[model samples]
Target chain A: MGAWRHFPIFMITVPLLGAVLLPFLGYVREKWVPYASLLPLGTSALLGVLLIGRIPSGGYLSYHMGGWEPPFGIEIRLDYVGLFLMLVVCGITTLALVYSRRYIEKEVSGGRRTAYYVLYLLMSGAMLGFVATGDIFNLFVFMEILALSSYALVAITGNRNAVRAAFKYILMGAPSSIMVLLAIGFLYSVTGTLNMVDLAGRIAESGFTEVLIVSYILLVVGFGVKAALFPLHMWLPDAHSIAPSPISALLSGLLVEVCAFALVRITLSVFTMRASDLVMGTADAVGVAAAAAVLYGGIMAILQKDLKMMIAYSTVSHIGYIFLGLTAFTAEGLTGAMYHMLDHGLAKACLFLCAGNFIYLKGYRRIEDLKGAWGQMPWTCFAFALASLSVIGIPPTAGFISKWYLILGNVEGGKWLYAAVLLAGSILAAVYCLRVIYYMFFQAGKEGAWEEYWHDAPPAMLLPVWVLSLATLFFGVFSFLIIPSLLKAAAYLL
Target chain B: MKKVAALLFISALAVLLLYVVASMPPMGDPDNPTATHVIPRYLERAEEETHTVNVVTGVILNYRGYDTMGEVTVIFCALAAVLAVLGRERRGVIHGFVDRSEVPASVIVKTMVRFMVPFIILFSVYTILHGETSPGGGFQGGAVIGGSMIIFTTIFGLYESSRRIPLKVRAPLEGAAVMGFFLVGSLGLVGGGNFLTYAWPRVAQGLHPSLVVWLTVLVEVGIGLGGAMVLTSILFAMIREEEEIAPAS
Candidate 1:
């Protein structure tokens, strides 16, 4: 068939092709990247919509390698789970690209602007590959690609702190990646194939022993570092706080969410159901991950001064909710975890975008320095308020709906203590969100004329903040629309 | 005492490296029982598939091209960092490190080095080109070729090296190489195969086994070019820095 007919492959290729072509665009004109990068992203976003439609009717779309059928050759499977993540990745990536036009101009010079777009596209391609790959080894390779580019992108600002932060990210990321490699080695030793579907089938036949348990644990710890789950989250605050704002938005919003999605996918589809069949009652090991992530992330986020770092720490807290919901081991828990991922992705993206615009315009990242910013940048502050409300689990925002399902799942699973932690996490969210809101609106500035203090964000940056802020409410108010599909996806896992 | 301490340290490091190598399976043992993972698969397919004999090259260029892309970028980022830090200095300061008459390269040495550059480049290309059939591929050949530039910079001045090869080109060259690596790797993701799998039937059908090997070679060339450029840039930057810290005229 024609190359155009399989939009799925093109979805991954177009951005990459755009990345390759981006450098040459500079030769033609300086402005070429802004326009050229959009077309591929726009096309990839369009393909995501198509994939979503195809998945329900098609069961699962697997593209076999060079005509090598599954169980031997690598496959790229597009079921509901993969498509949902694809939508989030593409949606947020497109917004981040639009945001970067104005945001990047201020942060990076003209000479390096082309390189920024190329890194951005490479990061996106790796994430897409991470989600779509059917082989376990391929997933590790893609994870490195994503991590390496992000390390470069995070440090692209050329500040001392940015470099330091990027170094810290690499230090943690390198170990995590190596740990993942080691785990994959162990898994491959047991099962001859690196294809995950085939491994899952083989794992089911073999039964869960101590060796399998250790591998599962390694996978959790390794992926957890990337996912920023609780204790392993030492790198997130520094990396997130130091990166340029739009990059921070993408990092907090979708990057860890992708990692979480992979963890959920592997735990359920690859490790649990089959292993549980092999060794009954041992599914609780998977549940413990959710517990640790939720508990640790919540407690640490309560203690940060810098606004960006606080939000970054909060990601560690919020990621816990996703793990907790998943640990419940019910379909409802899985669905809630999935929904929580989407909710947090939107809420966090909005918050970071809003925070970024302020830092760009005002030149201060301290939470206290943001006092009365609401008066200065009403649009940005408004976006921040909406996102904060969503994060706080306010009704009719995406966070609340996800939180509701997660709490219900906890209760359904007869884990009242976990349910209470979920409630306490919401309260902590309220505390932090209100602190930012209170400082922005209530506290006086450092004594200046309103105009002197005023700093409005540009259209390029403001648009993404508002769009994601709207999506927070959109997912919350209309949680039902996506719920059925998410439920169906979760059912496949359970 | 200092000499004794230094000797002990050298011995420890040497022993550690030796231990690691000893622990690893022997170089081309196809039937090494420990070689059950992807390495064995590459060895089995190396000559039959790509026509080369070097198993390490075979794996580096074709089987794990994507990994090499990240490795290339690591060197690239290091080069960019060193350049960003040191590239701003005057050429005079960069050139002043060497005593003018100390290491004058002989005419024969110059002629041989110049001749070696193209052959080195060609051999890198050949390694990547024949990765599927042989053992040596993009990364090994690229390192060897890139090594020549460092050799050139050492004997010649930084000015000659910079004029011969600017770090600017290295940045883009690295970016393009990485972009190409991902593009090929994504084919597996797109073609109904796993990540980096050559799964698209229509695309695979049109190609002969040799042609598939050719495509693999194209990817290796990108890796080689990128790898060579990055390593040379790092070497140049290091030399330039050492030149700066020397006594001023």
Candidate 2:
């Protein structure tokens, strides 16, 4: 029962243990394995709810593995920030898995279904671990865990393009990993200790200077690739387009959020505000790069043709919003960025899932082909409309609140140009989102001028999509539950 | 041939020149005084607290378990990539070139290979398990397991080996293994410890800290297994030209 007391950890564990057990279980009936795999996650999600309620605000919680102390034994650390992130990731993961049951049964072959579940569970655990881990080196380990699982999950379709995209993702991903590893090596060479709290203390003791500046750059670039910050986001669209829908939801929704969370964690925790001021003379370079990402991602997304691919490109744009808020270096900016992280996650996951639903129901990929989809799958399209509105920063949607903070942050910083760019990016987002919406409702299907491509999705699919869609509005309306938590998380970081 | 040789020669020369340039550290080192930092001091102090022969492992598994989790995800991403790409093919009955010869495994070789599997797995487990107090880690263990799988594929036909453990099973196993590693790492979180910072006495009480360390190692073993299976399955599907592609349709 004490073991169950650590259910937060078990939520991550049951699925992980189940992963190892799954291969051996294959010797039994094949059909039962994916279902068996779902049990751990279902259990993990239930545990996650309990864990979230248990975690207190602004307080640190530590769980010893085998009872080891800091700088000696292994530890699992949780804060309100960590717990909240874990809840979002685990909760979405549960729904994604539920949706995957019917989706995979229809789309993937019987033999490969087990592998899909394995990769999916691995990804879920890795994302949770990424959020929960306290140590620097442990963060790197989780990064790889999530990276490899994501790679496999993306390639699961086994299309030639999936293979090619995975290969390219690796080509880009490997260097990023090596870069981060080298940065860690440099950090070790300088600081020695890899513990974040200890490292923070040591850094404070000495003082921030130039060499630390280089380390900051290295770490930013390293995490930047994962965070999809502008130039570094070249691999994102292709990778996202090629992966399966649930995998895409995991990737666009929860996985990248963890990476962004790492960036936020490192910037605020490792450097603290004082060190950040001293180290880079200001994180101005990061700020500038983030601004570029906003403009670049928005502009590039406007140019895409494929529906999923457009959403993928749009992710590049939205990530810019995350980074832009982060770089504001103000508490409001940071809080807004973190809040946007959750908001974008819900909105994007729904959008991608809806896109996948459209593709599956109708053999179409182009933005133009979505014409008349509203009449065919009204519920799905309505969900899409809500998610799209949320993403576009429409009033009464979650995205608007986050963007409002961002624009206000820019204005407060007296960087009116950045504010202008933010507004423009929002407009661009609306443009692309409306492109699909317009075609879906107004344009006729290929059957003829009057013909409509209308077919509602299975209840399983609609349920997850609508749930996320509604949450987008719910969070927008009652931003209070999360806004304070985001503020606390920001204070912890900033 | 001249172009190739010249390109190789130039590349080697460039590598040598870069090494020369890098050996100087940075020009502003004296003004910067990089080494006289406090984090370095803690690292210096780490040797006492960790009591591990290898400081690198001590920092990795114990000090920065969080980052190590991210690093493990990188490998997980690779394995997932392979699974996503290769696992979707339709398996069909043979209709093309077939291996007519029954190339049975020799008893001695089979015995040796069989003996080798447990030890390889054991050593990989040892590496990850002892990482807090030793040199190897999750990546190292995963590589070792992957190495063992290569042996399995070489001796057994890809078909038989893959059939024994299909991608469906392999994917879930991979997922669970990674999830398990994360879960173990997160144990400190639930136990009221920081993400990977366990207070040795309270969490373990009378138990040796090594017990907790060993659990982390065990988690790595699972990662190693999944990592190995995913990698081997991918390589097998890519390289193995069976008589017929499995027909999913």
Candidate 3:
């Protein structure tokens, strides 16, 4: 029990320690750094699996820093939601690190290679810390750690477009961070504690004061930018698409989901005690915005010519579905949201990795240019096709299970409009996802192009994509294995 | 037209923020919830509990050291980001800035920088060590140390500074210093204490109060050293010219 209690802190600290050691190791043996980067993430993923087993039996575990009890010291808490998110974070990180080896060696060179791995590890550790920590201020600290690393990673390619995109990301991201900081300040002033659990009780006692409302708005806008919520999602396509493929996978897969999860954690956990009207009002607002995002993102994605850009836009649309589930404020809805976070994370990462294989092999990102990819890279295209089906909520894929739950929640909540929105979103998703599949497999190609580019990705990259795509199918078919835990987490929250 | 929309947006946001700020409890009221709820415990028990007189330091280093660790990692990340963006290989000529090697440093400025560097470093060490009892701590002390290096570079130029403490030497030092904080925190766990908890009962029984104090000092020093190196590196990366690009095809 004693040993298990420290696992949450270990999950975060180990990756961070690895990140700190990477550059030095790079200095000593540059060849070894990429492989060395795997150790911490692999360990964290192992711990995450262990934690999933334990958290169900133990309920939530909180490890206070410096042995001080909270509302005093920072706390690292692992509930089912946090642990599940940690699993996603650590799992994706391990895969991305493995996938990055060949991609980074080919795309990035010199000291930048070492910097790439360092930032990757740091970003992963920061995301893990973001989900695991219980203190609001500590969450902000971790958010900045992740945010800064992401901005740098996006720009690390150093082309003119990438640099511009990263700078724009920083410009948009900084204000959101300040807004979050200010919201934390407001919450601290009112409750006099940074602890989430303590703040929840205090906020309920204080009632829905104007100050609290302001804090709520600040948090929504701040985290909204990071989550790429509609109207604030300007930075997502450029930043996510322009980054290296492995990084794109991480950013699109884990980073935005973590932010969305943070939003869910704050609304459902910290402000649980607020007036029912305010809570419902916040939900309505989020529901409407999410509905808008579903339509907007789907339509925009259909308009994109570049493959990664379309996927990035699809991320925005998928985030809407998660929000719709979240704002439904029902157990089924929350479960659906959480499940969607996992499902979308796997599907989207697979798509990005597949797209990276295409780009690496053929040196093109345009959808039209990939007309005959299915002939050359059958395995990669097959993975992409499966992931796209999952994204579009085809039956017997993970996306279907989450969308089913989401529709059930909306129907149960008596919100027919959101249900309609979900349907529209699925239809729109089909348009973009199938469009890519069509171009990849069905479209005729220019002469000699098919044979010239006919090569499969290295095993390192192809394997992870296949694993993720298959997992989507596996979970969809056998959701009973995961749904009970998701339900348990939801029950704990509501 | 774009300017107009931007102006309207900024003004509306400012107005909304101002309204919220006005509604907040008046600045620094002692009886405010922030002061009343959890702070009293920090104020009353910090000295006896954490054994640090400066409650802020105690709070930052002991009570909330995890956040401080993340902060150090943030600084480490900033340096990494700068390097990733600017550290491309080229034909000896730096990118982003014009070469300044043609200009010579003034004799008096060089002499002054040489004299000030050692004392500045000494004072930074004092600040880091004395932080538990006084106001100055790792971040401030680190800036002072880093500032000294910047001064050295300014006087001696980037070439000399690179030669003196080349990136090869500095990068590892910074990594090690940042890792030191994580090591100390994990060591607490290894010693049957919680993460970053310096006052484990087992340790207190063995080494007593000095161990906690020493742990605090160790973290402060680590942060100080890492911060100084990171700042110096950022300065170096910024001032150096862009690496010369390959000739256009």
Candidate 4:
């Protein structure tokens, strides 16, 4: 337990502790706010790297809070799945903070920047906690923290559109959050304990299968809304698109993915352990929903006109791929799904950061407006093209590697329909992403639109964008390095 | 049509929820999983292991302290969220509460609130301090403290109340709960147990034997202070709306 070096608890607390201190730092010295925010974040990221290496290859590191063991105190469990996602969360967050140093100043007004940093720290820390915790109720607590912060982050700009978007997000998010809480209540009532391990055991021993099935449904629907699964995703495009680009990136890249991961954890790690027929039977239905999310999101993305809006829709489509792979439950599918989380996270963050750069520099958010934008900002367009290629599942990009596994998994699971749907979704992704790519590189905007002063976004912005974009390509070519661990994780969950 | 659709959806959810509730083991059934497995430990071992007379306090502050910490952070986050959306309260600007300096409140109302506020605050302090031994704990006491502030603001103008608890005073205090968790957890680490553990080796110097009780009280106070500040700050932030008013003719 102590061997993980207290990385699990400290990693989460450090950021939250930083969040608590931020307002005071701002009050005492306004200039120190961003640096103070970055210190805890960097430490968390560093700890994430250390902890990932320390966890036993196949086992988890679980430490009881207050030294009170299970069925009593909360436990912090850092497994491969949680660790993988935490790194994704911490890594992208670190980059985003670096990116935000400048973007927040420009997008968010002066007085609100400290609040932005505080909320961002809370949001990132909660996301990390959501993945790492082994307790069901604790999961809900972390979810609330992340949910609240993200809602506020969405509306932080306080513009009419941003506020309206956050309102819609809350409208969908709040009730679902309650549904999730209610489902936890249902579990606790039936099972007595809130720890995942204990609940799984109690559920098997208990006679209340009916209650368990209903709780499962509620969790699916609740988490479904949180993840913006196809039917419940009406809130995402507006919320993601209207948020500051970094927030749009964070929401799209990690926040929704964390919800999806929680779904996987609960359904696979807990319910499936019971081998309840009703739950497994319903899971196939969730798979169908995931497939629909894939196609629907793709079509919606293809239909989108605004740059961030299109990427937002693409996230809907990409998240579909992750869920599709997860529901397949084959080793290949799960591996691909897990891998998709990483690749899509990197590619999408890059896409949004690049989008932010375009808006920040050239003031272009529309595809039509992006024409000839490359003439002014070559590097950003290149990063955008690379990321778009990944999104479109072009060969040798991270997206293609994961898409390959997803299709393989679908086929392995004998879900040819889903496999076909996956391929078609990729084509649809190509249609929208390639369209943006073309306008950026080939087509010309209004003659004067190309004329601008600064060549590209400041290095602060471009650095994160390129780092993320390169990671996608790097992971694509070097998929071997990560896929093995993902497969092992998939096997563990299966 | 919209109303009809919403009603249909809600009814469907209601039926599902009702069904789930009905299927759960009867409330307080001696044989229920909660009573059989998780509850007995907390109820039976109230005073010894965790050193709290209140089982609820033991379960929250010691047994499942992490979640309580998260809950407190959630409250802190709510304040952050509000400020992020509405922006922070700045000095020298009148908030959303319109300036009522021209028309003052009645003497009785002001004096009554002024006198009542202190006692209310004092009770809140008592509740917080004795939380681990009593039915009440940090959250309940903190909410009351926050309620006291709201009452004060409603009676005395927002400006006067804001002046009383200025930003500089409450800003650092706002982080008390989280910092308390960190501080206590680190001390537990130093005590060679684990983070948030109450036990320490007996020593001649420093708080050792009652370390657990003291830490619990410490966390309770931190939560009460932080929660009160957060609720107050949120009101201040939301009410701290900014606009320029022209000088009166």
Poorest stretch of ten by lDDT in candidate 3 chain B:
B88-97
lDDT scores in order: 0.72, 0.71, 0.87, 0.87
Please provide TM-scores, in order, for all candidate models, with all chains considered together: 0.84, 0.79, 0.96, 0.97
Better of 2 and 4 by DockQ: 4
Q: How does model 2 score by TM-score?
A: 0.79
- Candidate 3 per-residue lDDT over residues A71-165, each given as its tens digit: 98888877887898899888878887888999888888676898899999999999999998889999999999999999999998889999999
Model 1: runs farther than 4 Å from truth? A1-5, A24-31, A109-111, A273-302, A449-455, B1-112, B166-210, B233-249
Write the residue-wise lDDT of candidate 4 on A228-321 in tens digits: 9888899999999989999888999999999999998998767855355666677788888888988989898888889999999899888889
**Residue-level lDDT tens digits of model 3 in B1-249:** 999999999999899888888988888999899889888998999998888989999888888888888888998998888889987222243334344632477788788889989999999999989999999988999999889988887777776776676666676777655577787887787677888878766654757578888888888888888888888878877765332442323
Per-residue lDDT tens digits for candidate 1, residues A223-266, read 98998876678899899988887788788888898898787778
| Model 2's DockQ score | 0.25
Worst 10 residues of 4 chain A by lDDT: A272-281
Question: Per-candidate TM-score, first chain only?
Answer: 0.94, 0.94, 0.98, 0.98
Per-residue lDDT for B1-249 in model 2, tens only? 999997996697466435534542465463332445433543686655444556676555555544454455455455445544554334453223343222578989888988898898788878766665667766677778778877776776555566766656664565444565566556555565544543343465656355555655565566566566657656665644333354433
Model 4, B84-178: lDDT tens per residue? 87777775655554654323669998889889998998999889999988878778888999999998887776688888899998899998999
Between candidates 1 and 4, name the one with more favorable TM-score: 4
lDDT of 4 at A181: 93
